[model samples]
Target: MNTYYYYDDKFLLTLYAYLKQTESSIVRGLSDKWEPASIYLEKHSLTHKLIDTLNSNKINPNEKFDNIFYKAYLRVKGKQFITSNEADNIYILLKAINEAIYYKKPQIYILGFLRKEIIKTSNKIRTRISCKKRKLLADNVEHYNQHYNGKFYTIEQIVNGL
Candidate 1:
C-alpha cells in the first residue's frame, strides 16, 4: 500500500485484508486457479514452484485441503462461491474495499475486523457449493487469477524447483 497500486477498484487493500505482501511494493503475484497441489503449503509457507495434485476430494490444507485456504486465498480463490449469497458477499466485500481504498472508508468496520471473520465468522458468510461446481469455478478463477484479473502475491515463496 505504500505506492497504493490498485485494480479497477481498491481491490488491492481489500485483498491486503486477506493476503499480504512486502511493504516495499516489489511483489510477485499468483492466481487462485491453483489446483490441489502438494501438502507443502501446510508444512511451509506458499512459495512452491509446481505442486502435486490432490488425490482426495477436499480443498482444505491437508492431504485433504484445509478450510483456512478459503479465507486466506480469496483473491485467487474467491470466485469459488456457488450461491448468490456467497457471490453477493464477495461482491459486497470487493465493493466496500473499493470504497475504503478510494473514499477513505474505515478498514475494520467496512472490511470487518478479523480477516477470518469477513470470510466466515464475522458475517458468518459461507459460499460453499458442490464439488462439481467448485471445480468448474476453480477453472474460471484460475483464468482470472492468472490471465484476466490476476493478483499481487502477498504471501511469497521462492521456487526451488525452478
Candidate 2:
C-alpha cells in the first residue's frame, strides 16, 4: 500500500515551531492567516495573478482552517469530510493545500516538523474506529473526498500523491 503524507495539526505545530525558532515573521504571518503566502509568491514570481485572483474571487485565505486541512487530509488518505456547502467557499485553503501537495520534497521540508502531530492524529482516528466501522469510514471518506467535496482533483491521484 502506498502511504500518503499531508499536512495536519502536527504539521501546523511544526511549522509554528520552526517559524518561532527562526524568527521568520513572514512564515509566522502566513501561519496566523494574518498575511497570505500569495504575497510572497507574488513578489518572487512577479506574477500578480494569484493576488488578482484572490481580490476578484474574494478568497479568504484565512477560513476555517481545521475544516480546510481536514478536507485536504481526508482527500489524500482517500477519505472525505467536507460538505458541499463548506467546499464551495474555501478557495484559499484549497489553493494552499494543492500547492503543498503538488510540490513535495524540499518544499514539504517546510512542513516536516508537523509529522509527529499528523501521525498521531492519523493513528488516533484509525484506532478509534473498529474494523467494520473503519472500513465504512474509510469508504465514506473516499466518497466525500471524491464526489460531495469538490476540493479533491482525482481520488486515485491524490491517494497516489500521498
Candidate 3:
C-alpha cells in the first residue's frame, strides 16, 4: 500500500533543515504549511475579518500580512492545532511526520514523541500513522533494548546497520 504521512507545517521545516545540514533521506510534501493558510484565507471568517480590518486600516503590508497569519494561527492555537504556531512546534511535527512517511514507502514507519491520548483520538488514515505514544515500545521494548544515550542513532549507524 502507498502510505502518506500528514503533519503540520513546523515539523516539515525542521526536517527540511535537518536534511539540509546532513543527509538527504527525508523528502517532504508541500501540504504542511500553506494548506492551513489557504484554509484560513478561504474558509475562516476570522481570517477574513483580520484581512479586511488590516486592509481597511492601511497597516503596513508586511505587518498586516503577519497579523493576518498570526490571528489565523491563533485561531487554532493550544488545541491539537500544532501545539503552538511557533516555528519550532510546526517544524517538529512536520519533521516527525516526514520521517515517518518519507518517500512513498510501501510500509510507512512513524517515529517520534507521539503521545498516546492523541492516537486514541484519531480515527482515519491519520490514526493509522499516529501511535499511541510509544505503544510499540510498550508492546516490545525488548526489541529496542539498546539505547544510544537516550539519543537518536546517527545516520551513519542507521546506514551501516541497514
The candidate that wins on lDDT is 2
lDDT of 1 by residue, 6-121 (tens): 12111222222222221111111111211211112223221121111111111332322235564345335442222335334444544443333333223334333323433342
Instruction: Show the colliding residue pairs in model 1.
Output: 20-154, 29-153, 32-76, 33-142, 47-157, 59-65, 60-65, 60-66, 61-65, 61-66
The best candidate in terms of TM-score: 1
lDDT of each prediction vs. the true structure?
0.26, 0.32, 0.28
**Clash totals in order:** 10, 6, 8
Clashing pairs in 3: 10-90, 10-91, 11-90, 11-91, 11-92, 11-94, 11-95, 12-94
Alpha-carbon lDDT of model 3: 0.28
Candidate 3 stretches greater than 4 Å from native: 1-61, 65-85, 103-112, 115-162
Residue 1, candidate 1: C-alpha displacement in angstroms? 40
The residue ranges of model 1 lying beyond 4 angstroms of the native Cα positions read: 1-81, 105-108, 111-117, 121-162
CA RMSD of each candidate after superposition:
18.3, 16.7, 19.3
> TM-score, each model?
0.26, 0.22, 0.20
Ordered by lDDT, highest first, the candidates read 2, 3, 1
Worst 10 residues of 3 by lDDT: 20-29
Task: For residues 95-118, write the lDDT of model 3, one tens digit per residue.
Answer: 443433323332222321322211
